[model samples]
Target chain A: MKKLMITLLAALVAVVTVSAEVPAGVKGKKLRMALVKEWGTGTHMIMHINGAKSEAAKYGIDLSVIDANHNLAKMAEGIENAVINKMDAILISHGKADALTGAVKKALQAGIPVIVFDNDFAVDEKTANGKLVSMDQYDLMMGLLSQMALVQALDGKGNVIYNRVANVPPTDKRHRIWEGAILPTYTGIKVVNTIDLGTSNPMPKAQTALETLLTTSNNIDAVYAVWDEYAKGFYNAIVASGKKIPLFSVDISDQDLAMMQTHPEVWKASAAVNPSLVGRVQIRLALKALAGERIPRYYSMTPILVKSADLPKERVSMKDLAKLYPAWGSSDAFVEPWMSTLKK
Target chain B: MRQEERRLTTKKLDIFGFFYKYGTILVTIGALLYFSLTLDNFLNFNNVTNIFRSVSIVALIGLAITISLTIDGFDLSVGATAGFAAVIAAKFMVIWGYGVVPAVIAPLLVGVVIGLFNAFLIIKIGIQDMLATLSMMFLLTGISVTFQDGSAIYNFMPIPGGGIAEHTMSKAFLAIGQGKWLGIPIPVYVMLVVALLVHIFLNYTKYGRYLYMIGGNQEAAKLSGIKINRYKLIAYVMSGFLSALAGVVLAARLGSGEVDAGAPYLMDGVAAAFVGFSVLGTGKPNAFGTLLGALLMGILLNGLVMMSFPYYSQDIVKGIVLLLALGLTYYKMKHKG
Candidate 1:
């Protein structure tokens, strides 16, 4: 009877340990993750949420989300709720970070690990509480190199308008990369004008920004906007300007791809990310953080440059989008002991 | 009380009396309940506060339109005036190194100037109010875009020359956009105060009474020896000032100066003002009713968003709701006439 009791007690303890959702050395424990987004110009929000969800399923996690729809007050509320609920972890993306400083600080003090992507704030990315990441340096390099090639195509000499909101950190880094990696090599190209797209919707904002630029200046050799929507503005502006110029940018939307496919001469190329992959990467980071694994203070997404010639024939068909930019659609398995170590 | 008075009081609770008294409020409550039930998290305190905050800007703009419609006149350039004021205020903070006082005051002055321009074209120069204001609308939007060579004004960036002028949007200015008071967004407070003041002015003040009379029937107002043109001038100037005020608040809220920021608000303002007509079957534009209309829109938008409905589809729902409101009020008013 004593031996049977000992065996049964041991089994009960083992079962209890396996069922408990402890953060460290734990797998298959349900993790509650929350995402509060500031804005997503296109399918950016949809893909990002989907990517996080897909990855969460692998980690045995439940995800709840809120979108601010560009309201700072609404965005701030989300952070407050996440902190108040004492969530396992929170991820925030793509918004003015200054507004959420107080709420995010509260979350950090509450011992909730926060993972931020593209939302650099007053705090250093290297924190015990969280990590801040950007698009991969490799992706920045790809975007710069593509810009260089386009400049070279113009015989290393033309009026290049830095059309993106260059002051923004994400675009700022790419601008630095362009200056450091590409511009010094080809001194012939000059930045004639820089577009200041304030806070309008990217579509109309870009169009108006470029249209205004067309009035005083002419002889633009090429335009480089930070994203595909910014590039679309250039395409529309160039059409309105009654002038044709090659346009280069990063980000590939269905609209961007369609425009690039039809107006190849104007909408030249873009450095595109597999948004779904980006989402998965962010979730992987969150999961890793939850598991007490030390992650890099910062990480960037490595994107691929897809030229007009490289895209599929039908930009809007049933054809797989991955075929258009195969380089971006990488499925490199994440190697980690805590990850994929599911409980029996 | 007398028996007759008691009878009248009892009748006040009847269908027509109820509709006349509580129609808009009732519809709004219905919407609130419906959204709270159908959409997850829609009934939460944070979400409800958010809806109010989101509508605050549009509500103020709607208030301005309400005033314009009250005078039997319309201000087509209100949205353009708003956009122009936003860029101007942003430019002051970002480029001119001015304090918040100057930044705000400058837009108000511009609003006065714009009002004078419209008033001149319509009252002095004998242009139809609608046509004149419409012309000013295009001109204002064009000028707003054309200013600074079409690029938006920001703290630091490459200018026309090879040099970069560096500045930061003032912390005080940013606070106006991002600050909260009493657990409520500052914009909501501003909206309420402004709307209430307008309500008092239109309903209680002698100036307001004259303005409403002018809107009701201009010839009768003139026959009563009212300075019709002077009232029209005051009305337009007020409209211009209010439009500029909305612009200033928007700039403060967004933390950046944007071009055409007010462009989208024009439709929203018009919608809210028109929607007010059905509230309580007033069939006329009023501040309180306009705010309520904006509330309806805010609730609808919040509910749709929470349900993960597409942004584009929200417009379809808005159109449908607007059509119902218009059909109800316009049809009822026509029958009564």
Candidate 2:
């Protein structure tokens, strides 16, 4: 009986010791964080916000989301406001680095950890006296995957309609791949037309332009859309024209998924990183940095290629996307054991 | 000696007037001719229709600006009103699952309400037209963002707080933007019909004359028993309705409601209206001139795109052309004064 009692005691002790616990600096603390975005529009941005919000809730964090509405000045001001309010950390998404660098420096000077997604800042730990985590979605890989799919699907020989939006960092990177890698590799693929419509409501403009192109030119084989917004337009134009041109693009949303599934033959494939996963990963990194964890200065999220033929015929939202591709909706990166206990 | 001086002045005025009237038309023709000569298929029938289709929305918005100018008032809210109408239309279809008719008519009603609000602010409160409309612009933009929670509205889109939108954009609505009848784009027909109606209303109607007289001199119009306030009300209402129409067409063309979709048209619309002031030596806003101004811009932009002009450089070209057009009109005015 004494031996059994001692065994029970040992087991009890083991269970108690192995239970999850919050990290030292974050334990029982009412933490505050701010997510300042350049703009919060479209499914991608909304998903990012939703992911961050859900993750922040798990940590009992007071997360405030500030949308600058595509105004750089306002985005800069958002970081300043967070610094003034003395938030625990800051997360910035998509702004001109030049406009945000000074504000980021201010936050760093205040000893606040800053994690930026997609927007590059000049500050480092040595220069800014604080932790700065720069995260990218690996747009280059996204470009390569989508462009290669286009070239491969066409068998490297066809007339193509290429859409380009210049000056934007992601689009610029995508275009660089097209200009340098794809063009050199697929010499048989002839670019019959290049379309660039200024970014506001581009779908309709792209559709109109493509419709005109279809009427004006013949023998077009396929199209490469750098952004899914352009892809949506091209898809619609092709449908309206009753043409059988295949489209390949970057980025994914519930709407884009629906279109792709409905007409897999046309919207052949798209390469994208789950936007919600991006938001969750960002929060994870921010929490890790706050807990005095060592984090790399730069991190990139891997992108996945979603082919239309792979999707089920039934409609699926971003939530359902994970069943088909596990890595897409969930990320294990930057997750610490303490995070499990931090959940409210 | 007095007769000789009068004759010299008349000749000079005639020469200036001739250029003012024909300058925009001549320049448009020169561009068309040049593009036709230099670019492949630039003068194709389909290409010409495409250019008109592209500018159709801008032309409608320009007509809205022109109407506002008739009463010496500028409706800066036109673009916002158009955007607001688009959001409301999309909500009716994508969110509320309503039919096409309500989606179209509801926004027109909203436009009327906006116009009534502008009329009250400008006529009753005696606020400056520019300030009143500018405030409306900001208000509508904020309301639009708030309405859809800052995301665009499309068919089967996932709404905020959960669940997917049920109804997609209807075929009839898409046809308004994407469909063509008799080998011409539908928007081109809409633009031409609206322009013709506005031309008749502005040039041949007593109401248009009263509005112009009020714009020329409000006090003089009031003294002449023209009911200046009533005329100003008419001008603003027309502006609001037309801007809403432009927004509707834009929504149809895109088949989705994007926030600030109509915002880009504001500058182009205003430019077309101002440029119309010197068209045909009218020295004032007119519908035909506004249509012509939009066409000129459309032709130049389309030609530039075909020529492989960089997109960033295209804006510079637009600015330069705008400056040249305005410089001639204002310089002539300055000289006459």
Q: CAPRI verdict on model 2? A: acceptable
For candidate 2, report its TM-score: 0.93
Instruction: List residue ranges in candidate 2 displaced over 4 A.
Output: A1-21, A128-130, B1-17, B159-163
Candidate with top TM-score is 2
- The residue-by-residue lDDT of candidate 2 on B1-337, one tens digit each, is 9999999989988887787878888888999999989977888898899889989998999999999998899999999999888888888888898888998899988888888899999999999999999999999988987897777888877766777788887878767777899998898999999999999998899998888898899899999888887888888888999899888888888777886777888988988887777787777889998999898888888887665465667778778767867877888878875
Candidate 1 per-residue lDDT over residues A194-302, each given as its tens digit: 6644334655445534554453356678888876656766776676456788888877654466567667778887776677776787777776555555566667666
Q: Residues B1-337, candidate 1, lDDT per residue (tens digit)?
A: 6999988866854665456546667878988999867755566665666677678778888888888888989988989898889888888876777889999999989999999899899888999989999999989977887663454565543344644445556867755644677877677888899999999998899879999999999999999999988988888888899899888887776555655678787888888888888887778888888999898987887665444353456678778767867776776676663
Clashes of 1: 6
Candidate 1 deviant stretches above 4 angstroms:
A1-344, B1-21
Per-residue lDDT of model 2, residues A1-344, tens digit only: 67436534543443457556555556677989999998788778989999999999988899999999888999999999999999999999989888889999999888788988986787765764437888888889999999999999989999998989887777888899999999998899888788887666677667767776775677889988988888988988888678899999999987788788778899999999988878888888887766665677888898989999889876777777889888796888887766887785
lDDT of 1 at A138: 45
Instruction: Please report, in order, the local distance difference test score of every candidate based on alpha carbons.
Output: 0.71, 0.85
